[model samples]
Target: MVEDGHFWTETNWVFIEVETDEGVVGVGEANWTVFRARTVVQALEDMERFAVGLNPFDVETLRQRMYNGNHFLHTPGVVQSMVIGAIEMACWDIMGKVTGQPVYNLLGGKVNDRIRSYTYMHYKWMPPEPPEKAAEAARHYVDKGFTAVKLDPVRPKEGPRNPRIDELEYAEAAVAAVREEVGNEADILIGTHGQLYTHSARRLAARLEPYDPLWFEEPVPPENFGELREVVDSTSIPVSTGERLLTVHQMAQAVENGVRIIQPNVGLTGLLEARKMAGIAQAHYAQVAPWMYAGPIAGAASVHLCAAIPNYLLQESLEGWNGFHNDILEDGLEWDNGDLIPPEKPGLGVEFDRSVLESYAGEYRPESS
Candidate 1:
C-alpha cells in the first residue's frame, strides 16, 4: 500500500491472454466490478475448459455454443457476460492475428469514418467553490479541443437528501451555469448513475432540458425496465442508459421500452457481447452510446465496437487521466474534435505493456478470486 501510497479504488484491469497451437496469442479483459468477483473468476476458469483447444478465429460460433450450453452460470448477469466477453474478444484477437486484420474489419466495417469521444470528469473535482467552478472546468475542456463532456450531476447517493424537487432545482442551476460557460456547441451528457428515483429523475430531466444536453443518462436506476421507460416517457430529453445491463436480452428490453441510446461497457460484457447488445439496439432503430469507464484496453475495445456498430452514437472517453492507462496497455488513442481513432494494428491494435503493467501491478492484481 505504501508503494503506491493508498489502494486505487477502480484500477482493476484483468486481461486474459489465450495462446494458440500456432504460437499466436489473443488478449481479452473481464471487468468484475458488476458481479461477485469469485463467481466471475471461476466462470472464466470454466470457460477456459471449452476454449483451450477451439479455433479462436470463429468468434460467433464459440459464443453461441457457450450461450446454449445448459450451465448454471448461463443465467443472465455479469458473470456469464464476463465469461462470454473474455472468450469472444480473445477469439477476435486470434482471428486478427491469423488474418492480419484489425478487429474492426472482422465485425463488418466501420460505420462512421471517425469515432466521436467525450471525457468523464469528476464533478467534485471542479473546485466545489460554486456552480461557476464546474463551468470553469467545462470551458477548460472545451478549450483543449474536446467536443463533449459527461458528469454525474446528481449527488452520489442512494436516496434524496432533501425534497426531490429542491434537488432538481439545484441541479438545474448548476447545469445551466455550466452550459452558459461551455456554450451551445459543446455537448453535455448528464448522468444520474442509476441513483435517482422516478419522480426525482423526471424533475431533474425537466430542469436539464433547457441546457439541451446530448442525453439524460440513467435517470432512474436500471432495475425495472418499466421505471426506465417511465422516466423516458415523462421527460422530453432523450433518455440513455444500460451500462449496468450485461446481456442482449436486457438490452432488448431497454430498447423496447424506448431507450434512445444503449451504453454497453466492453469491460463488463467483453467486446463482442457489447457489439451484440449494440446490434440488438440497432434493430430497434435505437442508437448505441457505448459505456467505457476503465483504462485504455477497455477504451480501445469500446472504440472498435463503436466503429463496427451501425447505430453508434457518441462514445465515452477518459481524456485527462494521464499515465493511468499506460499501466496495463502499450498503446493509446488519439481524439480529434470528438472522435476516438483506435490505432490500426493486428489483434485489438495494441499489446500489453508488461513494464507498465508491473508498475501498476498492485492495482492490476486480481480481485476476482
Candidate 2:
C-alpha cells in the first residue's frame, strides 16, 4: 500500500510478490517516478495472464512471451518493460536462491573486479556556488578515494531563463575551478544539463574541451537529435547522455547520431533491455556509462548490468557522507577506492531497510489526497 498519498517524487515503490504452490514467494520492485508508478502497476496487472501459472525458471520464454504478448507496450520503451522487468529481476533472484549462485554469476559471471563509479555535483540542493568551492568539494571526494566525478556546470539559480546569458559566467567559473582542483588526473564528467541552445551548446562544449573531461553530457538535451548531432560534430570531447531516454530505438538513434558515450538508467531502461541497448552501442563502438540517481538497490542493479556488458565504461556514484545517503539503504555498498562489489546476492542482490523507507516516506500532497 502507498503509505503516502500517491507516488510522485517521494521514495515510493511498487513491489511484486510472486507466490508459488510450494509457498515460495519471490519479491521484486519497480520503483519509478510518482507518475509512472500507476503505469507499471497497470502493466503488471494486464501482463499477469501469461505470468501467474508459468514456470518462473523459464525466464527467457517468459520474457519473450511478455514482450511478444504485449508487443505494442514493450516496443516503445520501459513502460511495459518495467512490468516485465520486475518479474525478470524476481525470477533471477529466485533462480539464484535455488542454484546458490550470485545474480552476476547467472548473467555470465563477472568481467571486472568491481564496478567503477562517479558522483554527481549540482544535483538540485547541491547547486553550483563557485568554481573554487566546487573544486574544493571535488578534492574532498578524491581524498575519500573516489577516482571519478561528474558536475553540471550550468544551472538557473533563480528560475527559468528567458534566452539570456545569465548564469553563463558562473557556469564557466565553476567548471574551471573543478578542473583546477582535479588537475587533469581525475575522471571528470561535465554535464551541461541539456539547458543550452544549439549554438550555445557547441560553444560550451568547446570551452570545457581543454579540461579533458571524461565526457560532456546532455549538452543540447534529447528532444532534437539534430541539435545533439550539431554539438557532437563541433566538439572533439566525448559526449555522454540518455538518462531521460529509455528504449533501444532511442539509443539506436543516439548512437546513429554519433554520441560517443551512452548513459541509460537501469531503473528506467529495464534490466534486459539495457543489456540490449549496450549491444546496440557496441555495434557503433560507443562506450556505455549507465547513470545512477536512485538508492542502493538501483545502484546494485546497475552494477550487475555493467558487470555483464563488455562496453561498460563507468557507473555514476555518490561519495557518501553521513545524513545524505545514510537513510537510503540498510548497508552501504562496499566502495574500495572507486568500485562497488556488485551485489552478489540474488536478483538485484540487495534489500532496503523498510523501516528507513517508512521514516523517509513523508506526506502526500496530491489534489485527490
lDDT of each: 0.73, 0.71
lDDT of 2 by residue, 1-369 (tens): 112221122445666667666765565666564666656666788788878788878877887788777556556455666677677767766676677776677767788767877776543224446567788778877777778887777764321222246556666677788778888557788876677778877777776777777888887768778778998899898877888786777888988898979998776766666888888999988999988665455566678888888888988875542243445557656777777777666555555567876676544344544
Pairing residues by index, what is the TM-score of model 2? 0.84
Residue 157 displacement (Å), model 2 = 8.1
The estimated TM-scores of all candidates read 0.89, 0.84
Clashing pairs for predicted structure model 1, backbone only: 115-339, 117-338
Maximum-TM-score candidate: 1
TM-score for predicted model 1 compared with the true structure: 0.89
- Badly placed stretches (over 4 Å) of model 2 are 1-11, 23-25, 35-43, 68-78, 123-128, 156-163, 321-332, 352-368
Assess candidate 2 and give its lDDT.
0.71
At residue 290, give the lDDT of candidate 2: 88
Per-residue lDDT, model 1, residue 167, is: 58
- Which candidate number has the best lDDT? 1
